[model samples]
Target: MSIADPVAVREHLLAAAAAGHPLTYSELLARLGHPFTRPRMRALCKTLAAVDDAAQADGEPELAVLVVRQSDGLPGQGWWTGSWEKHRFTGDWTGPDARLLIDRLQRQAFRYWQERAPG
Candidate 1:
């Protein structure tokens, strides 16, 4: 039996997640042109789960998806909130401006977390 490719595994998983449905490792592998092998699938799922946990802890937004619509005679965009998340901001901004705002927010969050992290 051939070993599964981790790069392929990640890409498949990310694509599946982006498509709005989270798939288990077996489902991911099956979609990735392989009959799922239990050990490899387990290892891949563990690694992906750990990476996802770290990103969430660091406040890196998963999905980073923006839904846009017209509201009150202006265009607006916002993220979908669920569980522990809250939707924030509804202003219309240019693409570059949005990038700048997101970048600044990320930097601030990084610094704030660094200050709180144990050395």
Candidate 2:
């Protein structure tokens, strides 16, 4: 699959959600048959935003919240400061507050997508 394919990425993220777990960028890329690189992650982030948009349109939680950093278990800066502004977190984008919010959002995603999604 292409690196920027939002559908492919959403499937992986939903699988993680079904497991009630989060995935690191490297892990996600590997699942997609690619290696980790900043440029690739950047492109992936865009697709993630689009995926989130669709989810929001469908009244679902942001699935991208499950795609987190390996070090912090939190979404990358792109998510925190992305263009999707309805429920955007405007704080430091890190630390306790951000963690709490991200955690809540991720749990919501997990709860919504953890239905053993068909494919």
Candidate 3:
């Protein structure tokens, strides 16, 4: 699949979710036959979020995608979790301030998702 192919990506994600097999970022990219890259991943994330919104209009399950940095000492070492239900994120943080910011963002995102109508 082309890296620009959001339709294919969304289809794969929905299939995986329906099969009870959620995908990590790497796994999702791999399934889409694309190599991992920051830009591609970001685009995919955006696309998946849009897909979730569309699905919401049809009363389909939402696809929740979460990306977090790892504390393994490797810069930019992170992974993504994608599922049909929202997942709470809690782990090492850059600092207390960063944690607070993340919390606020997460809460805002949750509310947005909760109140969004299919568009």
User: In angstroms, how far off is 26's CA in candidate 2?
Assistant: 0.6
Give the lDDT of residue 83 in candidate 3: 31
Q: Put down candidate 2 lDDT per residue, 5-111, tens digits, no spaces.
A: 88898889888998889999999999999899999999889999899889889887888888889998888888877733766666777799888988888888787
2 versus 3: better lDDT goes to: 2
Better of 1 and 3 by TM-score: 3
Candidate with the greatest lDDT versus the true structure:
2
| TM-score, candidate number 2 | 0.90
Candidate 3, which segments miss by more than 4 Å at Cα?
66-119
Alpha carbon lDDT at 102, candidate 2: 83
lDDT of 3 at 57: 80
Clashing pairs in 1: none
Summarize candidate 3's per-residue lDDT along 45-95 as a digit string, tens digits.
776666756766876555543333334211122222333134344544356
State each model's C-alpha RMSD to the native. Answer: 12.7, 2.0, 9.3
Over 4 Å off, model 1: 1-7, 61-119
lDDT of 2: 0.85
Q: Which numbered prediction scores highest in TM-score against the true structure?
A: 2
